[model samples]
Target: MDLEKPSARRQEPEGCLVVAIRLPVRIVALLVVVPVRMAWDALVVAGRFLNDTVLRPLGRALLWLGRAVFVWPFVGLWRYVLVPLGTGLAWLGNVLLVVPAVWLYRYVLTPSGHACAWLGRGVLAGLAWLYARVLTPIGHALMWVLKGLGAVFAAIGLGVFGALAWLGRYLVVVPAVWVYQWVLAPVGRAVSAVVTGIGVALYWTVRVLFVLPAVGLYRWVLAPVGRVLAVLGREIRDALGHAWRVAGRISLAVGRFLAGLFRWIFVEPVRWVYRTVLTPVGHAVRDAVLRPVADAARSVGRATRQALTAARDSVRQARADVRRMLFGEPRQREAVARREPTGRETRTLGSSTTALTKD
Candidate 1:
């Protein structure tokens, strides 16, 4: 059988057909509404593109120029001008504050020497006034006490001196007087008696000798002996004089010989040895010993420097090796690739990335 036509089978009343026609009217309204919405969306996109492409760059340029002219100038001025000005003002403030205080302190605090002189004069005047008003009575009182003490001391001193005087009289003076009278007086009288007897005998003997007429005989005997003795004394003096001259000559020769020996042995030999041997020997020893020591010190210093250099190099190499072992070789290839520009290659890569992102 043939399928019935959908339009022929539909049994729509006039009012329902009118309603279906109104549904088409609503669809037509949507067409105008969708177009208006699309137009509004397009205006928003255009406005954003205009702002980003034209206004944003202009604003950035204006901001950069404003910073260069205004902000940067002010920063330079602050660093170079305003800062120093402010510092000078601060220094001036400090000087103004401190100078007055210093002046005030100098004015208020008096110098020690001047103040001390004034104080000393005032104290002396006050002391003199006090002494004039009160010291006489005080002095009298002191004198009275001193007088009483002096009287007591004098009484004690007199008692001591009296005892000493009594002891002298009894022990010293009386014993000395008794010894002089009893012992020394008898000895003196015996000496006087012996002396008087010797004088009497000597006088008798002199008288007897003088009466015998022996003076001429004594003169005759002694005259020949005196002549003989005078001759002997002259001979003895001549012999001593000759012996003294010979001894003086011998002493002069010995002294000359000893002086020549001393000059030869001590002075000339020592001079020759010092000039020829000791001075050269001392110089040679200094050069031989000190030169070798100085060279050895220099060699040691050079060796130490070389050893330190070798150790430093070894440490640096070891550090490099350790770094390589731990972190491996750095990716210098990536850095080199970044440094080496290939324009077509970069463009191809950018296009491929953009295509992938779009897909």
Candidate 2:
């Protein structure tokens, strides 16, 4: 059978009904969508303003408050209270449990283990000696006696087995083979033939009554109807999509016009007032008032710092005088002699200095 190529499949021509339906549908969709698109754009702008002015700051404050209330206490407990407690517990366990365990293992258990191990080795050696010297000859004699008895029993068993086999062949095997060949084989063949004939007839009856009609209905009626419905749905979807995009462009142009009008009326005037009026006023106020106040504050801070330094020195001098009056002067440490000569008494290059002559 030859298969059709993809390009060989032709598109159905659009009828007048579809063309008529499309124009009205698209017009209705565009009118319905324009208002919805503008509303959506307004909602977007409002949401952004609300987020920037109110919700974002509120969320930050809530986050900080939550950290203070919920997170900081747990962090402080882990860092300050629980961490120290755990450290102290670990130290106490090392002192009370680990130290004793180590000592007991080192001094007590080690010697006891060694003694037990030595004892076990001696016991094992004795058991090994007993097995090697006492048990070997007795085991060999017993095995020889068992081998003689096994040979005598084997001869008797073989004769009995042979006689039973001869009887079974004549009584059981020959009769079973005869029945299978003459009686069962013919009956089985007849039953199989009847079943095969019934199955063939049933297959053909079901095909004629049910399967053929279903296939014919799908090929002749249902497929064509499905194709028509699919084309109509595709056209409707395309029209709606095209209308929505055109509405969005129209919404964008309207938004730009409104924004320019608002900027000209409100924002530009506010900017002009700030630039021409408020800026010079603010600069004049800063130079006339704030500069004098800052200079006086700096001078006051310098005088205060000098007074504090003077007071600190006076207090230190009084403390020293009180100490001298009460306990007298402190004793000075005595100087010790050194192997190297002092700087004032050092030898010059003209002076002869040897190890023997130095003393």
Candidate 3:
């Protein structure tokens, strides 16, 4: 091998010269893209896994904290304190104020409304019933009279027509019959025989062609069809009634189910909440807040009573002092002696003694 040409170098192993020169570029590319590739695949998976493991729980904890911080206090106040207090207040108001008002309306206005409605209904019913009882019968009687007159006229016309028919039969039919018996009978007997034969043939043809077939059709096909139709109609009517009853029952059941659903959705939940959650919380709040308020009120009331008693005593003392200052002392009559009686008074006493001794 010639050492001057680059491909024919025979001293390649001396300085570790390899056939390929891609190792540096590959090492550099790995050094550059390894982090990016890891970020694209493994980092994303690690991020997702970490999110599920740590961040999601942290988010849930934050949500719970938010709910506890914001929602719980109001819920407590609304359910525990405000609801019971409002219920009590509403009960008090309803008992003291609303019930009487509702009773007044019920007893006063409702009866008046009912009376007015009854009066109006009675008036309307009276009018309608009066018409039905009196006017309708009168109208029916008048109509019957008019129909009777019409029938009488129709009978007269029918009787006139019958008389005319009888008169014409006597005037023409007897003459024609007499002529046929005397003059035309002998001449037309042969033709009458031929006509009689023709009539007999036509009669037989009608019986065979139309009457017998009609009777057979009526007996065999039409009668059976009518009977089947009647049975089908009866079955259809019975099925319709049965279906109506079933539909009614289903509707009743559905109504009951809907009522139960409403109770379950609304009433039962509220009852459970009131029983399990609200009742306990309300009792706790009563112990915490209302008891203290009641104690404070009692203390204040005692203080007020003591103050009022002091004031009342002070007023009585002031009134007694005013009475003593306003009223002066008066002397009694027993403290002074009587003046000596005059001679006239002594004479009067003597006269009284004389009268007493006489008595």
- Which structure among the candidates has the greatest lDDT? 2
- Compared with the true structure, what per-residue lDDT tens digits does model 1 show for residues 237-333? 4334443444445545665787799999899999999999998998898799978889999999999999999999999999999999999987764
lDDT of each: 0.75, 0.87, 0.77
Sorting all predicted structures by lDDT, with the top scorer first, yields 2, 3, 1
Top-TM-score candidate index: 2
C-alpha TM-scores of all predictions: 0.22, 0.71, 0.28
Model 3 lDDT-worst window of ten: 14-23
Model 3, residue 138: distance off in Å is 62
Clashes of each: 0, 0, 0
Model 2 over residues 243-266: C-alpha lDDT tens digits? Answer: 677777888899899999999999
Tell me the tens digit of each residue's lDDT in model 3 across 142-191. Answer: 99999999999999999999999999999999999999899897879888
Stretches off by above 4 angstroms in model 3 are 1-233, 256-265, 329-359
